[model samples]
Target: MSFQGEQYPGVKAPAAETDGFRLNHTMLRIKDPQAALDFYSRVFGMQVLRRLDFEEMQFSLYFLAKLEAGDEVPEDKARRSVWTFSQKGLLELTHNWGTEDQADFAYHDGNAEPQGFGHICFSVPDLDAAEAWFDANEVEFIKRSDQGKMPDVVFVKDVDGYWIEVVEAARMADKGD
Candidate 1:
């Protein structure tokens, strides 16, 4: 399939290579664990599914997920660990010790001059409500939904300056038109 005069090769991957494979999570380096936790939990309703601390290494990993209604997290650590790995679309936050104490500390949000990573996205049930909540909470926005060419979408920043794109799930049905 091609769009906008660009040809897209119809590529196929070996079934064996993709059969049992799933994307586990995407990791983001955070300077302050508490701050990052607060932002993700409060803004996106993500819960910390599991926390792994490497005290000897002076770092920690926090796995977060947005649990669905009536879904319960496994109580057993082993089961929870397995479940966490089995689930798709998880966010992992890594915190290196002592970073919070530094007066001038910030993570490379991957959207600077030589941008590498772009942004994480959240599909909300109501984009307008989400934007309003963000505004009321004084969340920093890189681009407001109404200001963009795609008026129904929003881009906001987290405590560590990572960009998060917010869009209404209903918009997906519209195909951006």
Candidate 2:
């Protein structure tokens, strides 16, 4: 069945939320800094928020995310040709130039799945619209099964092959009122 939050539509939309403390970002280990930066910037439109270079370590980290107008992106961020806005969810890229033995892993590749680790999910107002957008953009969903009475939910991989779950929230809107 669909999930219907009591205040979904009838009431004024849920008040904008402030998560007590500001969330900093998410860090990812990438092989090629330039390639990874290009992929996220070109495909997702995420701006580079910041960068930290460790000369001794020979590694560079790039922080990219959505940005709002007038947001001040540090000068270092410009070095990567990426920018960030005042938005949530920042993607941090860790690039090590001298390290060659590091093991590579995807978000879903490890067993024990570990606590504090899970798939990122997006709630869509309309599943049909989402599916259409995915089709138009040539995005593929990995596991999409919704034939039964339960609500429709699908899992898809991001550009980096990270699993993301997309759930349909609008179906519940038709149940009442």
Candidate 3:
């Protein structure tokens, strides 16, 4: 009875003209850029790809990603901006200028009572190892794999209280054709 096999009635197929379109990144508003950047780099091993600052607008955008071995990242900022947008699965953290200075500043983490955005996820090669690493890093856990019906998935909260689902890639269901 799972919806996985269902065709999602009334949903039309996307046009071939949209073939080149891609999901560049998901943006999350963070109070502190440095804290978020450090967390992503230290825990998720993401590197900042490009940073855009809008001074008059009083905000900044930072794009981050885990580049593979063969990926060629340009040294030029302009080229890097284009290259960053071309890749998929990048995480963008937006910071409104003075929010970090406000001691009580907080963003609605989507999982609260009026839920909207769910979560971002990462596929780790080893679930057990990831759990251990998270423990060592003192990552806050919403759900441990062994504690839930789903035994291979783990949910942890980031510095800003955004839930991030972690899973073992090998256990993911194949997209059957």
Best by lDDT: 3
Please tell me which predicted candidate would have the highest TM-score against the true structure.
3
Instruction: Give each model's whole-structure lDDT.
Output: 0.89, 0.61, 0.91
The candidate with the higher lDDT, 1 or 2, is 1
- The residue pairs that clash in candidate 3, if any, are none
Clashes of 2: 8
Looking at model 1, the pairs that clash are none
Task: Spell out the clash pairs found in candidate 2.
Answer: 1-150, 47-83, 48-82, 48-83, 66-85, 67-85, 68-85, 68-86
Per-residue C-alpha lDDT of model 3 across residues 78-160, encoded as one tens digit per residue? 99999999999999999999999999989999999899998999999999999999999999999998886777789999999
Q: Show where candidate 1 strays beyond 4 Å.
A: 1-7, 174-177
Instruction: Return whichever of 1 and 2 wins on TM-score.
Output: 1
